[model samples]
Target chain A: MDLPLAIQCEGVSKRYPHFHLQNVDLSFEQGTVMGLVGPNGAGKSTLMRMVMGLIGPDSGSIRVLGHAMPHDQIAAKRHIGFVAEDMRLYESETIAFHMDFVRSIFDSWDDDYAQVLLRRLDLNEKQKVKGLSHGQRVKATLVLALARRPSLLVFDEPTTGLDPAVRKEVLDEMMNALADETRSILFSSHNTLDVEQISDYITFIYGGRVVESSNKEDFLDGWRRLRLTNPHNRPLPDLPNIKEAQQSGQIWTVTVNQYDDALPAQFTQAGLTVTAVERLTLEEIFLSIVLSAKANIQMKVAS
Target chain B: MSTSIVPQLVGKDLRLLSRIILTFVVVSLIFIAILAAIWDHVPAVVQGNFGFILLIGPAGTCGIVMLMKTNVLEKEKSTQAFIMSLPVTVKEFTRAKLWVNLPVFGLFWAAISAVAFYFAFARGLFPLGGVPFVTMVFLGGFVAYTCILAVSLVSQNLGMTVLCIALFEMATSGYLWAIAFLNPISQHIWGAVAVWNPTAVGIVAAQLLVAVSVIVVTLLVQNTKRDFI
Candidate 1:
């Protein structure tokens, strides 16, 4: 039996005065985590907001846990636990007040899990939100969301402003939440290291469009930075999947997205000697994809 | 459209605002007590005019503070996003705000109106003729509040909301002056008995109509809104 999708967004488009997110298709299966990595103004937050039904698409269909969007948003939201970097609790209220508020609304709220998160996160329940530090506030929001036992958790830059130790604690808690194997998460972050560590699948979004999305292993396996030597300084041949190329005298460094065992032979057949082949990290790969996409758009505009 | 979540959200807001509401209520009752103690010492006109201002002050301030806490500050502080994250639609959120805020203001308004009514007609402090004018003034404050609430909901912009409040306050002052000096409604102010003249009745009717219309239009606009941050 196939796992049902936790979220499905097809032909999603949203147009603002200065930005347009166009023709996007995205989905992730239940029981998995998908990391959405993007640069600033890359529409990651916009997409997440749409997924949470905080905003509607200009034209597209979105389904969250089998409920249609904006129409059945109330039903859809009951199962979604969303936390964004800018989301805040009532400043005058305490953590316990918020926890009680959430508990009253959600029948699935787990008090035991809430206490566990409070202990693990080192959050004081009686502390007012205004008195807590930034990291504490984020943890409080996370605890509020997590303790609800939501089937789908959507986090937008949840770890953006945390210290290293707290980030690890948050990531670990998120990992622990998935032990049931029926829960899913879609989190967007600029921290590629966190994404690489926790994501089962990775997606790269740039300039309001998805550039690349696949399993983490496939992403890790497919991209390579090759250092080639040209003794006679002959012009390089047109190569497939060359995301970027930089030259210095006889050395040419080429980045390719479709790396395989046969790529070195293809370079040799073109009269170039492969000096070194380096595996690209997710950060490097993400930068290459974004730079390449930007170059493509610039080239099209120039033409 | 989760009717169930609406009450939950309303309950949350009430809990959060309970202290502020209590503070305002206590302050209002204190103002009334002060007026009652000074009722015989001041001249009748001074007591009637100045005392009315003192009586309405706390309730009006309460409405403004409640509006700011519930609507303006939430957006300014980004807590609206947290509220939106709950299992609620924009409609349900609006409904909760309306349900929580309007009644709190209504209760304050009604309480102040009751005390003013007791002093004016029951205890014979002011001429019974002043009852219509007092009712119009109280109703005028309610209309102003509803208008401000509508603007806050529909615009969701701090600048616009502030502007709406300022404009309504100015309009209210002007309306008060016109009714006191220029309108035929003033004829009944010093009469021996309360007179329900056409002008007095018309002004009251119009105030109610505006208050109801503003709220209805606000809900309709919220229903069509596609994006709420």
Candidate 2:
């Protein structure tokens, strides 16, 4: 049996006066969490909006849950629980009003689950949204989205601008929601810690293009920071996945996307002594990729 | 599931505009009471000439201002984000706004027109010959209303909304004066026999046509929006 994909974006490009998302092809299986990591103005929100059918892509096709986006979006959105940083509840109304409103629209609304989430999220149903704190506001949104029991949850910077405690609470709730194998999640964030903690897959995008995308373990295990000593002041070794290499005196620090046991042997045979081969965290890898991508752009522009 | 969303959205908009609805109801009741109290003791100076103005003036002004305030003139831009996130298409949203807003103005327009017509044609307090003129003037309210609603829904720009309001206000005021002095309407203004001259009927018919056309054009324009957010 073939499980349907939750999201698919092929050759999806959106152009603005100041920004563009060019030919982004992405997909996630039915039961996995994909973290989209990108910097400010890097088109993460644009991509998410395109997937939600909020904005039509300038070119290419987007399919969410097997429905063509922006065309069958009304039908597609029935199974999508989307929350963005800019999206907010009615401020003048009480939380109960919003809950009732959402419940009336969606037959899949789970009242029992909504009540459970209200307690776990520490939200008061009677409290007006304007009176809630920032953390409470986010929690209320989360409660509303989760209680709908959508097949896919898409979050665009959901935990942005929250304190550490609130961020952890939100992440914990998201992880708890993903326990069902049939559900899928896609969240974009600048906070790599949040992404690293809950993401099953990671995709790095920069300058309106995806630079790296793979399983979380593969990314973590495959990338490494190598510390080497060129005692004879030799040139840097040629490696297929060498992303960035910097030298100070006779010591060299090389960041590679593909790292394995044989990499040390290759460096040794190149007349360089390998001193330390340390694994890179997701944050470090993201930074290295972005920096390398920026340098490559500069080189192309210069040439 | 998607079929029920339009009603759901319309229901939400009604809830959002409930305060305005209540205020409208209250103001209409007070005006009706005032008209009932003054029915028997009309001043000779105002009698037989624009007596219904006292009723229609407040109703028309309040109808326009209240509709614009609750729907078109919203500076907060609230509820849009939440509404857009749901399983609603642009057509559904536009339909909901139109469904909720038009009837709101219609209710007030109907009540005010009914009260005025009752006193004029049925009770014989005001001259029946002025019915066509009053009808045409009240229909002017709808023209202003459609202008504001269409512009606000399409542009969502404060400047354009204000411009529409200003143009409609100036045009309505001018048109009312122009129609009141027309030979066909003023010739039979104080007469006992009710008259539906070509000018009066033509103006009323034209106003209704504009109202319907404005609504149809607005809905069609709204359907063209690809970027709803």
Candidate 3:
């Protein structure tokens, strides 16, 4: 399972006057999309900036595609295409003008494929960049970026402020962009479903630190929500996987993050009913993860 | 080879710059044309010669706007995203700007020179002598543009722009006074230090010195401190 890595950062740090992004480390392999989710101002954009070589870290090295960043950004960026919700287009120029402008600069530009995206995204070739709606602007930026055939496509909340239909269009476009197995994408979002639907790897960033980073399916595995009754009044077994247990009167609810095949038998032996074992979706997992991380931070702050 | 991103970056800047440059060109052309049409009507040589000095205002203002405004424009739009996404390094971005706009400012200076030559020739029927006039124009413009560049690089807002201009003037005026023995009339007289006074040789040397210093400062400012990116 050795994957050729695309980006790697170790001991990277950045500090503002009041806020600090302390010691961050992250990595992603080639061809795998990594979703970075965090609360607003949680340093998601800052970290991305560092990774893109838009800003250099105060200390530590960053390697993207095996080249050191900021020092190597010029070469690295040849393969990297980035988009933000606030896509900066040449406002006074038409979409065709920008296509030519970008095309002249990058030899890899695919004019035919660009036309295809323009038609598929329902954008006008002659439309002025300033006149396009926000959703259309996103589409235009996406088309410009995608047509370059960039190996690393980074989207920073590409769906923000987009209507549901436009969001789906963008999401579908992203999936299409991934049809090439050697290409990769990194996008940050607050929308868990977007990540769950598309990402192979998910990293949860909370309060300037990565609280969780793992394969998407592996994270969803070994966790469950259980609802049971305490009517028989049997003491629960010493379960290694139980994260939290709550009991009210004759009813008990339990959450186990590390479950095994013997769990139902063990519950039966303990004279308690295992009424349900339901799976937690990505959104639910996000909520639970955020709550636990916040609690952990607070406990550390208190101690 | 990557077609130096500088050109791409400058292409975007020239769009915004043309508005200011066009405005200056129109106004300067009209003023110069009107002055040429009325040169014989009655004016002191000193008044007219000094008026030539004031042309620096419009041209210098245009150059400063071209450099400073374009530098901050992307930051103003979406400070977090615009520059952060670009692969253009801060040094390359800043140096491209400082170096590129010189030619832009040079074009403005050249236009002003043409206007001055038209005015001078129209005033005198023949042999008006162009070297001194063009030299003064270039000298005045070089001083104005570079001083403005130094200040604009460090300042954050309009108030700071005003303050940078004021500080630059105070420092250079000190040099102007010291060079001539327009001598500080006081006894605590290091006020007569070497940094002040503007004589021809000293001023020309200072112009060259400022040019080199601009390169260094431009590199330092862009490399050392970014505007909260």
Candidate 4:
């Protein structure tokens, strides 16, 4: 039997006068966390918004928790906890008012957990929302989202403006929300450290398209940077999966994806001594993917 | 449909609605009392002149309430974000907008107008012939309020709302001025009894029809919105 998916999007596209999300396909399996890593205006937020049923795609289909988006969104929302920087709580209302308001709508809201979060987050229930700082506001939204214990949590840049201490606490709370094995999370962020610390799977998106998506371990293992000494100055081999190459005198640094143990033999056969092989961090991988994609686009435009 | 969705949204806007409603009621009552006092003491010529002033309360009330609803509640970005994030459809959101403005402002307008019209005709403060003018006042307010409410709901854009108000004001001023001087309505203004000429009745009927049509059109347009955010 095929594994169940919390979210699935195929050939989904949206168009704006200045930007377009083209032919995007992505999926998040049940009981897994998928980190959407991208820079600003990379369509990460747009994709997350589509999955939350906040925006409708111009073409293609999206299913969230097995319900068609923006059509069965009401039913899907019952199981989805969405948090974004643009999403806000009522300013004049107190945290208590919001808690009651959200609790009124969701039958799954847990008062005990809500109380725990309020205490843990150090939020005053009687305090008005506008009085809270930026970090506190984000935490308040998180408290509201998590207390309901949604099956799927979708966060769009939840930690963008938060301080370091608050960011860690929020990330911890997210981890706590995921203690249940059946729960799944799909968060979009430009912060790779947060993604590296929390996500089970990683996806890189750039220029309104997904560059790569895979399990975290597979991504970490598949991309390697090899430092080699090319004394002969022989022409570099046209190796497959070579993302980028840099040279200084006789030393050459080559970055390759889908790296394997057999790659070293190929380097030796080419008469190049492999001095060192270094694993690429998530941030390095993200930069390489974006740069490579940008270079490819530039090359295509030039040609 | 989420059974509690509309009410929940209504509750979100209830505080602002309550404030506007209270202010309108208190201010209208005071204005009506002052008008009644001036009617008792002032000369008949002055009474005839200020009788129309009694309507300023309800008309002003309607305009104020419409302004508050559009400017403070629905059109604000934070409030819109909060509302659109809820597990409610655009239809439900539109219904909530209608619920907040129409009934609250409608009831306030009706209550104040009834009291003002009662003093004007029933209490014999002004000639019953002026009934058509008072009715025109109420109908004009209803049309303007409905147009503003409809535009705010459908577009939720402040610029469109301002444009609608400006156009409604210009059109209302022209219509009122034309009726007061033109053939049909001006002929019956100072008569002994109130008269409902075809033109007067027709204008009133058109106002009612346009009011209801705008509301219906707003709902229909909101239903077709694919992107709630």
Per-residue alpha-carbon lDDT of candidate 4 for residues A1-303, written as tens digits (9 for 90 to 100): 764689899999999888899898888888899999999999998898788776889998999888899898788888888888777777777999888888878888999999999999899999998899999999999998998889999989999989999999999999998899889999989999999989999989898988999999999999999999999997777887999999999999999999999997888899999999999999999989989999999999999
Taking all chains together, each candidate's TM-score versus the true structure is 0.97, 0.92, 0.85, 0.93
- Indicate the TM-score of model 2: 0.92
Per DockQ, the best of the predicted structures is: 1
Best by TM-score: 1
Model 4: per-residue Cα lDDT over B24-71, one tens digit each: 677777777887777778876666567656656555655555555643
True contacts kept of each: 0.89, 0.68, 0.28, 0.53
For each candidate in the order shown, give its overall lDDT on alpha carbons: 0.89, 0.84, 0.73, 0.83
Local accuracy of candidate 3 as per-residue lDDT tens digits, B93-148: 77566755777888788878766665555544323333332354466556756766
Q: Best to worst by lDDT, what's the order?
A: 1, 2, 4, 3
After superposing candidate 4, which stretches have Cα over 4 Å from the reference? A1-4, B1-4, B41-75, B123-125
Model 2's number of clashes is 0
Question: How well does model 4 score by local distance difference test?
Answer: 0.83
Q: Which pairs clash inside model 1?
A: none
Per-residue alpha-carbon lDDT of model 1 for A113-143, expressed as tens digits? 9999999999999999999988899899999
Every model's DockQ: 0.79, 0.62, 0.33, 0.57
Backbone clash pairs for candidate 4 read: none
| Docking class for candidate 4 | medium
Cα displacement (angstroms), candidate 1, residue A107, comes to 0.5
